[model samples]
Target: MNRLVKTALLAGAAWTALSGVALAQNAQPASQEQEATSLGEVVVTARRRAEALQDVPVAVTAVTAQQLENRGSADITELARSTPSLTLNSARGSNSTLISFIRGVGQQDPLWGFDPGVGLYIDDVYVARPQAAVLDIFDVERIEVLRGPQGTLYGRNTIGGAIKYVTRRIGDEPSMQVQGAYGSYDQIDVLANVSAPVSDTLGVSVGIARYLRNGYGTNLTTGNDHYNKDVTAARASVEWTPSDSLFFRVAADWVQDDSNARHGHREFAPILDSAYDTRAGAGDDNHVETRGISLTGEWAVSDTLTLKSITAYRDGTTRGNIDFDNLAGPILDIPAMYDDDQFSQEFQALFEGDNWSGVAGVFYMDATASGAFDTVVGLANLTTLTAGSVDTKSWSVFGDFTYDFTDQLSVSVGGRYTSDEKTGTVFRQQYLGIRSPTFGNAAATLLGSPRTNYTRTREFEEFTPRASVSYKITPDLTTYASWGRGFKSGGFDMRGDAVLYPNTVDGYDPETVETIELGLKGTLFDRFSFATAVFDSSYEDQQITTQYPAGATVASVVDNVGSSSIRGWEFEGSLRATDNLVINGMLSYIDAEFDEFLAYIPTGPLNSTCPTAVGCFVDVSSARNFQNTPEWTGAISATWTHWFADGSEIAFTPSAAYRGAYQQFETPAPLLDQESYWMYDASVVWTGADDRLTIGFHGKNLSDERYKTGGYSFPGALTGDSLIAFYGAPRTFTARVGYKF
Candidate 1:
């Protein structure tokens, strides 16, 4: 038997065993007069309109605030454990920077010029940068994850997928809530929310949160905590409804993270006994701040027509240090700073006829991103300074409509036309000291001439389309087929060395994907529901980023690699075995391969294929693999509730998640890849008789699984070994309390 097939079978067996246990518990005898219970309906806005989840043709997953609270989720990364075909992690050295992938496609480099494969949105406003995108969970109503292309209705064009975070709206009545939690490593968290109505047509709301925790490990050289958290966040909103046909809202939000710089564990010789402990020499001072504000207006022109507008602006700043070589000496140290800002406006018109409904929108955005970093090599008394800035302007117009030929059959189509222009400025130079003059050094001397100093611009235009057909086999069952196209514009590389690679001045071309999918969503027996999908995609002009040695420093290159093919299967289901017990499970499998990869390979004496030069360009598709794409991911969970005679209640929830082995980079590195692993979590909560007071205890990673999330491998690039790995958190326990009035 094949190894992958065997592993998948074992995981499926475990899930079945767990399900059998839940079924046995539900088989107990019940009172003769006990009434039956059914699952509630789930409403979503996946198509820019509110509709039932089963009625939508798209493949999406919706998670409610109650579900998050029950699982004791802290940040967006937790979604990966429940959502199939999704992966998320914190960037290398920053606590708030996000790295996301969906369906085997995504970008890992968080530089100023690179674009993210998965888009992130807050209340319909797009976030242009990933520097401070790892949002904390507080005062949020729900979150939605869309699996495929989402360019028709959204404010931006995302190639792989999109994640939407929706905030809680102001209520009609006055209310206040406060929550607190304390846990391992002296963790302390406080969250508060308040809402009040000023008049019959006006209302306001405010939310505040504070999170603090000690590090999981310590820095031996700096005596600072590692992998700690210290953050403050707040949000405010005002709503006005002057009349019955018009509405307006204004919202503002801010977040600041002051956590210490995160360092990776050395994977070479013995440096420390613990995986989390580090001896990095970089100073421990890191900060990130992000703020945004938006205004939204809606007006009803007629009984079947409406118009809406959204305007938003956001900005962020980051300062941090990264110790590439986690040792006592500054063999490969980096100090970096980033600044980014974006402004966007969107206008939409929605219409509803007797048998047709649709939405048309126009979006425009202008953004700027800039960053600089100093690579210090104390052993050689040399420092390389690299700085770059990118400015972007883009606009798009899109529309989607669904027409019903019959009550049981319908067809939908949508298309988007987008134009993007990017301007980039790159600068790279060398200095003769530990630090550069740009990074607060006053006496640093210039070593040689600048390697790269140029400005360039590129423009790209694309039209993507989507179509779907749906039919209801029965009132309780539905099936659909869809095909969509996705695109992502390319830009110049920030660290490209023009002296060595002259072609870097022109930049790379855009990448695109076209996928076809078939899906089924239905319910049976009023107690079980399931959603399944099978998809195949053709990817073209893929942009690949690589690092190579350049005389005394490292050079970053971006190239338009060849094509690829990807196929996957996803399944999500929930069963209500009893009125008080429910079980949920998800399974996903993906097979991604490079169809053609043209790369530069070194030549050897024994290989006479190309003997004229030191290297030759050849096809290396069979030798490469997709990064961060696991072959199989599975999860199973159960929730049970019990009622006391005095009207009090308690709920018990337990879950387990599994992920198969995957590489971290396109170039395979055995030492950096992570093997298959499983994680377990459980929570218990008790509510008082009045239902206004609650207490909960939660445990995560119960088995204390030690697994890698990300890493860096640059063998023989610096003085010492440069193989470092970052790990997920270990076992943790927390107790939380809350009150409402």
Candidate 2:
């Protein structure tokens, strides 16, 4: 840890020295002067309306296409490393199923009934399922990440924040772009986009991308590798403009993934082996498919008012088999599959008045989720299968109104009333004879029913509200404070089997959060832009999943854990150090803890809370913190672009990110605590004389830092070695070339 800090400090000093020298040499502009003096303004739609980043009161970071390309970012996980107060995680080694954490709130399990704390959207269309949320970046204009509660504007399950991916529109001129990259671990990526106008009133756009990489590690027992990636995606869109006041667009996309399951290292093995070695004897045959379509229409009713509508539908599926034990013989194996679909419609009216500006919207969504997984033990032909399905219908009415009393002072208020109805059925069965007589009556005693089937229906509703006030101290500076509420719907715990105490199909209660935030935004020296925010949030009825004792065994169930709170601050900025140099920095600090929490934990190296010799259930409330909550995280980067007298240019960018150590679970287990780590990345690009062709070299994790992102475990009474962990990727390098015409 000390070494990393020293390296970062040295790099900062070196950059500072270089900046001074560069500024002295380029004091007088040889090229354009306007571009050399001030940083470009960043525009965002954080408030459901287009506004300058400095003018909006919310804490947001807008990542441009050039910034993404410079970092060689392919997915949300890579992009998150460069942002403040945000983290991305993947469960069971499947990138298609993502987990996002913002301000200590997120869903760890991508199950059928659970809801995500953060909202995800593509061009204002919400994505309802985590199975389809891991979208690849292609032909995107920008990505906006809004921190803190956004339930009033985004509606439902936005207790943490929201992420928006906005794609570029089809232009009138014919254009094409092609890019390809090759890197370590036999990785290959390709992307192509083309747009053309068919006539004066119609235009079309198309994009395709393919990413392939070999596994980073090999299985010693089966001679097969894991963590490989094989994915492909395609998108098409059409735009129509029949009149000057009316516009419409329709788009469709398809994606497919065929990769191996996530691999893990044995925690209590006899031999201390290499970190990447695996002993699983069976193959992790994983596959996923996704398809979606959207239609958007807009009409200008008047000069100050406009109406917009969006309709969308999406379907996705995932299938995989995993060797949970990670042993040569595979004592425990899991085969899983899931399928989901969703349809949604939304309408909005935007109004701009002399003293007031606001937006009103109505939204409707219907979704279905289903999945099943089997537990196969040893060479026994016996299998315990758990299957379930859920159907959900949701509706909401939301509005936001802002009134300006003066040119320098304004206040805004908003609220959303949302309701959801959900129904589901669970079925549990053993294909053959029960493995043990002790496990035969799994559900009979707990639910007073046979281990056959159970049906349940539930309804949840909430009214979330928001209010804020801002004062423009100066034309270039703004200060604001806001208060808001967020809510997540109730759902059943599908992991409960016959051996569990909560075997009945009872739904959990909804969780809610209230937050207060203070912020400042301004421009300095006409060359630097900065934003800062301090916030506090209180959480109630936080949903938690844990093991519950039935008789002689334990079953997994979901329940309302307890209350919690979090306070944090963040600052982000960009500086035009020189005519051709730009420097950016982001820093964050958070203090998050559970005010009250009680749960059962497996007796292992990371926990010492079991009450009995065989690991008995006990309350572990006052001994731990929230899962995956890091105290401090931030990133810094510098870019230098120098244009030659002949108009060609070369650029170099160096970036680094740091994350403080934090607990991976709500336990006192040392194995679940990840240590602090740092990652370094850099890129160099050169543009051709015609400015139509480009080439670049990039490297990620240049220091080869190895860290654990997630893990799995069993009770000490169930297995001799109960814990295993998954590690992040190692150092990788890539070279790329691109052409635009």
TM-score of predicted structure 2: 0.90
Clashing pairs in 2: 442-498, 443-498, 606-668, 606-669, 606-670, 607-669
TM, every model: 0.94, 0.90
Model 1's alpha-carbon lDDT is 0.84
Q: What is the lDDT of residue 91 in candidate 1?
A: 83
Tens digits of per-residue lDDT for model 2, 435-496: 32233424322223346477888999999999999999888778888889998888877766
- What is the lDDT, from 0 to 100, of the residue 22 in candidate 1? 34
Per-residue lDDT for 707 in model 1? 83
Error of 1 at 424 (Å): 0.7
Model 2 lDDT-worst window of ten? 30-39
